[model samples]
Target chain A: MATMHTPQIVETNHPGHWKKSVKTGLKYIPLLILIFFFTFPLVFMIVSSFKRDNLQIFADLRSMRAFLPVGELTLDNYRAVFINSNFPRYLMNSIGLTIVTILLAMLVNSMAAYALSRLKWRGQKLALSVIIATLIIPGQAVIMPMLLLVASLPAISFEGGVIALTQGWLDTYYVQVIPFVTSAFSIFLFYQFFQDIPKELDEAALVDGANRFQIYYRIIVPMSGPVFASVAILTFISSWNAFLWPIMTVQSDNLRPVMVGLLFFFQRDVQWAEVMAYTTMITIPVLLFFFLFQSAFVKSVATSGLKG
Target chain B: MTAPTVPIEKSEGKPKKERQIIVGLLMAAPAFLLMILFLVTPFFGGIYFSFTNQRLIAATETEVVGFRNYTRLLSLSVLPLEPVVDETTGQPVLDETGELTYPRSREITRDEENYPQYAGLTEWFTFDVGDTRYVVLAGDPNFYRSIVNNFFFAIVVIPLQTGLALLLALLVNQGLRGQTFFRTMYFAPVVTSMVVVSIVWKFLYDPNNGLINEMISTLTFGAVGPINWLGNPSIAMWAIIIMSVWQGVGMQMMLFIAGLQQIPGSLYEATSIDGANTWQEFRHITLPGLRNVMVFIFLTITIAAFQLFDQVFVMTNGGPDNATTTTVFHMYREGFREQKIGYASAIAVIFFLIIVGINLIQRYAVKEKEA
Candidate 1:
């Protein structure tokens, strides 16, 4: 009988020995300084949000000015962002759009991907390959054509014939949010993940007389929470951050999402402080999403096709 | 490759091929139809519209201009390259450094060369081209300046972003104390809305009261030496490049860290036994391991840098003197803002071919070298 080999791990990988085992801080020291530099702007933004809105704020344009006590901090900036502006509307718009898009996209992609990956049919591989190939094409090159698609949808004229089909759809949420809700990356991610699932599970389910849809839903999706979470994170973040397309699509003031609102947050006369406050407000959801799913996100991104 | 004369006789009491097809189509209908209508059609339509005068109207309008736009774009004279010209003495003085060097506001008079220079001097200096007089537009020079600036931005920013990202990734992946926390912080910018970042940085870069100028003045002198960070023709593009690197490096870092994690510890241990120091270890062990990841990072960043629009859109809007207009931004402005959709499409087609060609050559060269 052959003996089984045990995997060996080194003790030096431990954090306690990391500093000691490595004498050249020169190597790691530069990295530390860079991380600090890269992260400082965000830190400064969060901290400054707490500062008093007195002359000290404006006068002390120098970040190194006489330190104001933290106790003197006020909620005035957040107050200004929320109360004085249409920030609440904008917030709702962004959150609603992100949530809807993520759910719709994930459901659609996972179903199609499961069908494509798990179901056996001729040329299925070729179809999946073609879909994946489209991802390499930059979204910008296709934006105008997309604009044309949205524009071609008959106008919202109830009196008209063809335009009547889209009578209320012209400037509705569907036009603004639906165009971008489909993602090739999501489909590809789900396909790769679905393919990795042992075929035995599907076969077992089928042996029990479960239909294809039932197998996908009851067997596959229940086991795919982590991938789902990661996809959800990416989809939400990307959708929330989406700017150009939304700008091109949404015309109604009430319908304008956070990105569009942020675009025109400051009118011709821009106030820098107010803009920062607005920026902080807009990024809150994204920041929260990343904080919650940083690990899962990294893994999902690692698995997502590395091309772009 | 298989012969296609197979018939599926039902074995188990389940749905047949036709039945499966119906169910499959029903299941996949929403996504497939949406993808085809929105994605596939736009692609074909983009190519078609690139050849047609299909700008102002919807898809119904069909006017084919037969390569005229392409010919015009191909024959374009690069907008002249001069920074703001001094009105009194037509000499140009602009900062080429990628740092914050431009002076705040109108501190410079005619005596000081840093005062804005105008490129509209061609009216004064007539060219004898077929005995006709020509007047140059003042803004045209800025366009060419931006194109050059765009190159500088790409060259400098991509390497810097990549290098720092690699360093951070190595550190975090070393299983350092509180690694996840630091990793999270590093990548926070990646997930954050770039528009918000740009807006916030706009305030931060404000020449008058931006936190950046404030910090600099306090650290050095008390004077808030405001830099025209995203304005002034000089350092505008570089400023955008700095912010872009800050927001983007995390992604590259993630890739590098992943790459680093894949390298077997045995190789490093073996190298260490041979007395390879930190630099040597990186150059030999770590670098060789990271070559594939590095190529991916390099090309991805290069392409992303070329498609630089969001920063220019949010921060500069093609700028104090059109100094930050990268190719994509130029294309957008031409097609959408100027309503010269045909001309813009030509630019896009040319750009598409260039990107594809470059990508193929890179892959081919890398493959050959690997072989």
Candidate 2:
């Protein structure tokens, strides 16, 4: 009777453990589905970029082979993207634009935020309010008038070792960078971060005979790394992905950023693999940046969402 | 001691305050000047331009148009269409397809002497009430369609995206292993440029050789598809919406995750003690906790939906039949493509008001809920 009872207990326990495992597996099904749904297109893009040509890319789409790097892969698509098009120029243009914009935006917006949060002066409140009020005006609203304004504005340029004054900012690199540098949103983000920092640090620096600029440089900026990181990431993403303004303002292929460049490439009848390669090339830099600053990016987006 | 120190501090602070003011002014100058130059100037110029006949190239002298652009954009009229009569039977005529035979909409719309209000109005659509078929016409039917499309996009995408984000947040918030991996995977597209996403999806949306159709075909054993995703007018906007949602849902998901983390675990513990199940706890605790986040996400997504342009421009170019033309896309087409800067500025003004209206309504609704 004891032996029979022991066997019965073991038999019941085995089934109960199996049932719990099954339930756990079932709970993960939704997550698995979502992961697949979100990642499949991207995976297909990367995989297809390496495929020999459009024929192989499409042929592989019929099965799970589309997501796998299993076909006759070649460097030809990437070669074509580089050798056959102006992709290299666009890539360099985008890279230079993104780095310059991020640096300038960080410097300009942070200084403004520093003044607003740390210094007490007459008219500061009014200035801050005016800046904040402009936040409601979407970029799309001002774009048309901005085009006209930029078109008639005077620009200084160097031509053949001569300083020449040119009318209109159209089709210029500064046109893209300068207008976006003074972002209200970036200033606000920096202001919020700066305001939370203890003012005692600034006072201590001042007691050490530091001037206002020195206090801001020595005290405020060092303590504000996270916010600076956030601003840089935000600016980098926007400037790198900028489309509407670039497309509207830039007509020269040499001046076009990667986004508008991709549009021009897609508009032309090209092989699917080449398109994929072009997209992959443009996307890798951003993806690498995102991966390195994953937590900061997530935190910035979360904060932005909350504030909105 | 206090009196002496206070006087000494005051004596030292005056010049320091003056110096601080000067420094602050200098520090703030660059950003302020640029804002006034680029943002404030352009904003007012846009409003000013809307009242004048301002072209990009200005082929003629600019003149004040006095609300002509606004009226042209907003004008709509509805006129009842009388059915053609059969002379012999005195009965209303029917077409061979068995629909009511009415006089062509153009004939009535163009008869300016009798129907001056309807002049310049093109037929938007027709509707029937009782036995009367009323033709709805607009001065700029394309603009009206763009507005409708904008609303359709916002209405569909806001709820759909918010719900999906919430669902994803809940799934990832469970403290499961490899949650970071899943989160990173989901966020890959958000980091990618919209242009690249649009181009990639354009290929994926190809009617014949697209992966989406191939997958569907394989799954169903080839019963459906090779369906024209972007080439069909009716399905084009929907295709864009799906792609847009897919591209953007990750950011909202991150927000939802942050909101989820803010909810105290003790509430769930307490609810579970009170015999609350998973659904009960979610409804009572999670939803209420995420109320502020939900309102924020909803407003942002709605604003973004109205600003839809890149995808439409890249994927469909507001076609198969202008089915996907959004307000911003329309503005771009008019302002840049057609060089009708004045008309585009009017669209811009209207777009700005709509955004403000959305923000105000959300604020009012949220306040009401809180009360």
**What TM-score goes with each of the models?**
0.82, 0.95
Say which candidate scores most in TM-score: 2
Candidate 2 per-residue C-alpha lDDT over A49-129 given as tens digits, one digit per residue, 9 for 90 to 100 = 999988898789888899999968898889988887889999899999989999999999999999998877778888889
CAPRI-style docking class of model 2 based on DockQ: medium
lDDT of 1: 0.70
TM-score of chain A of each: 0.80, 0.92
lDDT of 2 at B262: 93
Candidate 2: misplaced stretches above 4 Å? Answer: A1-19, A305-308, B1-10, B86-91
Q: Report lDDT per candidate.
A: 0.70, 0.88
Deviation (Å) of B265 in candidate 1: 0.8
